[model samples]
Target: MGCCNAVRLNKCDEYPTQYRTDFIRTGYRPLPFSFKECIKSAFYANNETGNIWTHFIPFLFMVHRAYNVINQFEDLTDPINFGYYVHSIGVTYVLIASTIAHTFCSHSELCFRKCYSVDRAAIIMQGCSVQLVFELYICPPSCYVAEGMGRNSHVILTLYCVLSTIMFCSSVHPRLGRFQRFLATLPFGIGSIMINFSCAVRYLYSSNAIESTCFGTTKGDHVLFYFHLTSACLAIFFYVTKLPERWYPEKFDIVGSSHQIFHIFVAISLYFQNRLIEHVTAEAKFKIETGELLREPLASACSQTVGIFLLTFITVHSVVALYYWKVQPTIQICKPPEKKE
Candidate 1:
């Protein structure tokens, strides 16, 4: 009772391993908090407060933005604008799903796993939805001339499915922890870059799309590749290093934590992502109306959405369900960490 008397306990020091998200984070709610308490804690200034609000605020913003997107077309099912709606729905769903996962993760292992699985699955769909629209309207001139419904397009789609599968499996594996999950994100990151590459190149460099109105109405529109790259880099740094909290866990426990920083940058990245979608959508619409765009638009965009739904459903639910059936009941709590002399 000597040194321990002055120190509050870390839940990870005693709880089952799956409940732990970060070794440096010390403000976890007790392992069996009820759903009501977990929801209530979102209001309290706990470690997850920032995580919850970052995604939740973005979710609300995107919901508003999606409503405006709906008004862009008279028919809800117009194929030309329909992919935009799919993208909007996917983004908003992931944001809200992230909010829910962070909010209720303390409820129980089952709830935690289920919520996070849903969040991860939503993210997969979001990536697919984004790349689908980009392929339809945001890709450059060469995309039409070289890969117009060609082999590269199918290759990209297959690559996404494969990488997403790796990410999903590593994410839910009982033996894999944060660091392994971080490694898993390498593949996830590759898939994400593939999703954004067509649009990102326009922001990063001169392109036929950029010279024309379909790309933009102004020169040097954003140079947003640097902006998003910085955000993603910062996010990865915090996620891997665990930052200032890694050095002084208690000082940053309730605030100034690395996860909070990570969440802030993630929200920023997604907000700008949606903005780019709106920007490119407007430009594409203008071109379509004026007959500037050649090559039929959205030949496979809707079909890809269906394939994405199937892939995500298979990989995501299988990972979660297999965890429940195989991993959950078998894992055991570990002995608390020992104090240094």
Candidate 2:
């Protein structure tokens, strides 16, 4: 039923076959697809349901975080707090858009592909957007054109933004087919390289200063930092090579799958990155607002943030993998034919 209708009936229950037929006749149609597509479609729906809700529900948690951060600004001593507001809004918008797109994507193939592309773009955009807090902390907007030492952070941030743009664009047009996914790999590969370079520059130029600024700093922070770097490398590698699982084929479909592992690792990397960024930013914020830097006595809050994200990421993906395993048929692995040997 549409607007102005007296009764809005659920089509799947009320008309079933006719509902689908009417939808197609009205130009809202799914893909002209094979059995393989049917399997993919069902699995996509299942995965979308879980993935959207898992990430979407966290918006409440984010709102709480935002509230706390805003409250932290009650003191006039705090540096400009405007940046975080925009950051929070951007994060919330991405989550909301992602959830809505995924939920309704199954309406049609055109819808599905467009929504999936938007979904992927949201992932990339969120990663890039979150980095801004760090940029703002290390160097305020005024320092963007600053000369000498203060300029390093600004330069690195520009590079980071450029790479993120590339990633978002690649997802927007991941080519036309299997071969097209390869094109998508290029931007992520480049982004990975640029990020590593940025990390190195950050550490080499500003390590002690940054360390003195953040709270609850520890050796593990460095460990997790490298872990994030390694995962980024692995994400790029897997995107390009499609290894292990590709080598073994359908054997790893349900659990112990490469893509699933990649997703989990990506989430883990983001967790670490967020912690590190928060630390770095807090340090920078102290420096800009006052001549001195102060560290939070307890980084328990940051740790909790990381922990919740990891738990949610793993639990959601595990459920999705299980659902796909039980509902999907065993796919026969196919390799591109070798030259007529």
Candidate 3:
């Protein structure tokens, strides 16, 4: 949205009325745009310009962090280190999927649904990945559902996928109320927060609770965990309220939108979470170097994480495809808004 001249922008009347709902824009990208055009449009000014870059920039930044992790850390094959690798993948995929969806969503009505369908699936997987990381690396053992609670992780992951599938269907089936969609996605967030809260309770309240790594060595206080939770809740509030812009739509069509603010907070949240893991990993690595800790590789957790991603990935998109095939015929073109004159 930095550009003063926008060659690809078109009036809102030129696109579906859905573009007008809860969103005000000076112009939107033309419909049925090519993928190549979508990529090229990221450089130009349009309604979704900020949305595309907000997540994409963080995606690139995380890629750089991944590179740093590979070079600076030893015992790279250790499962404790490897589990965080899995979390990084989830963080990376979520941003990339959001960027892709934002970039290509204006292509057509079908395109919009398909793009966001993929985005929702990616988000569900991210939640599952977060759970896996918490179970294996972060949570103190004193927490009720801490590490070694493999069964709890499985049940929570299954519930997330089931509710997420309903949410996926809601994205494709236009008749589903917004409240229905909200309800479907609520379980995943609630499940994740419950696990985190258990850790928080153990850390904050229990006199015996110790901040420790998976290697069984106690560490310092859990500052990063608290920061992660704070940033995450801030991001969620922005997402739910659609703030500032909802109060003043005309002033925020491009740069200062709520979605953009949400993306920034999400990035910060991820940074805090990453640093928390890195701290634990650093301590574990030191012990390993001194011949005090052995790398177990926890192959089971790795396998389970991969399974959750594949199952959710296939289930969500499959329902999306079926719904589109059945409903495409009934979908109608946008009628231009009538002129006042």
Candidate 4:
């Protein structure tokens, strides 16, 4: 039996390489350039401190979250499953795009503005993909005993992510300019509003069990709403007004920049938003399965909810900052080729 077990382990290890190679060939590479260059360019010249850290930090959080998912659900699923692996690859794509955008963006005039836009688009995709993967595990009724709640909640969350993705893609388009950015803001705004409104309606109609839970109350709902609102507003204002930094130009190059602030808030808000969903999903699952009161009070849940949000926010934001520090923009004014001097 011991010899048989040893042989089986060796065979299992060998099987994965074939699959891993397939993924390498077909899936997205995590970063396009050398790791050293990616880090170096992040702080070079753009003052893109927030942009670089935003994605970098989230990549770490995703690593942690992926681990938690594995530990928590070990029996029901395997961490090495294809769907799970592919989802992670998507995150790698986002990080690569973000790193590349930060690294080479300041290399040329064309690369500068384009990198910012590409980073924006990559973030949108990252946000959507995160929600999608979470849904795959939460949506099915396998874990939940209740029927209507699981299906309805899944549909609503999925729809919200889809709209958010569309809005992000449209709003971040390079050619759409300021006007398009404004239009793109609408979807996120609407989605945010709807989330609060639905929670309110759920409280009004649902029985005491759900209503009493953290997921339903207005006060509890505000935790997510306020942060998301602040984040989205900052991004919109920065893009539209082109504030302090834009007005001051060279003076704000290294710090005190509006774009940097916007990036920080956007990352923070995305973190908060995901936590809000995770809180509710975890609750909904418990409710459907046990049909008992939550282990913690609504208020306590709200606080935990907020903490998770900020934790994710800080980590991702740190990466954004470091990336920018390494890749500061090269500031040199052009003088019409200097007449061959």
Worst 10 residues of 4 by lDDT: 19-28
State the lDDT of candidate 1 residue by residue for 94-174, as single tens digits: 889889999987776667666776777677777767666666555543542343443466456655655664466457656
Runs of candidate 4 exceeding 4 Å displacement: 1-39, 43-46, 74-96, 107-121, 126-222, 292-341
lDDT of each: 0.65, 0.44, 0.68, 0.45
- Candidate 3 stretches greater than 4 Å from native: 1-15, 21-25, 140-150, 180-188, 191-195, 206-221, 287-300, 304-341
Clashing pairs in 1: none
From the highest TM-score down, the ranking of the candidates is: 3, 1, 2, 4
Model 1 / residue 335 / CA error / Å: 11
In the range 1-341, model 3's lDDT, one tens digit per residue, is 54436455766666655554355556577766777778878888766888899999999999899879868866576555665677788889989999998998766666777777778777776776677666665563434334464546566666666667556656455566566546545754775575576567655654543333234234353677778888988988887788877889657777778888888998998887777767766776676668665545344545655666667667656665766677445655444456787
lDDT of 2 by residue, 110-137 (tens): 4444455455445544544444444334
Off by over 4 Å in 2: 1-104, 138-179, 205-224, 237-244, 251-256, 288-290, 293-341
Report lDDT (Cα) of residue 144, candidate 2. 29
> Distance from true position, residue 119, model 1, in Å?
2.1
lDDT of 4 by residue, 279-322 (tens): 54455556535855344433232222233323433444444344
Which 10 successive residues of model 3 have the least lDDT summed?
A: 209-218
Number of backbone collisions per candidate, in order? 0, 0, 1, 25
Q: Which candidate tops TM-score?
A: 3
TM-scores of the models, in the order given: 0.79, 0.52, 0.82, 0.49
For lDDT, the strongest prediction is: 3
TM-score: model 3 vs. ground truth = 0.82
Q: Model 4, residue 20: what's the lDDT?
A: 17
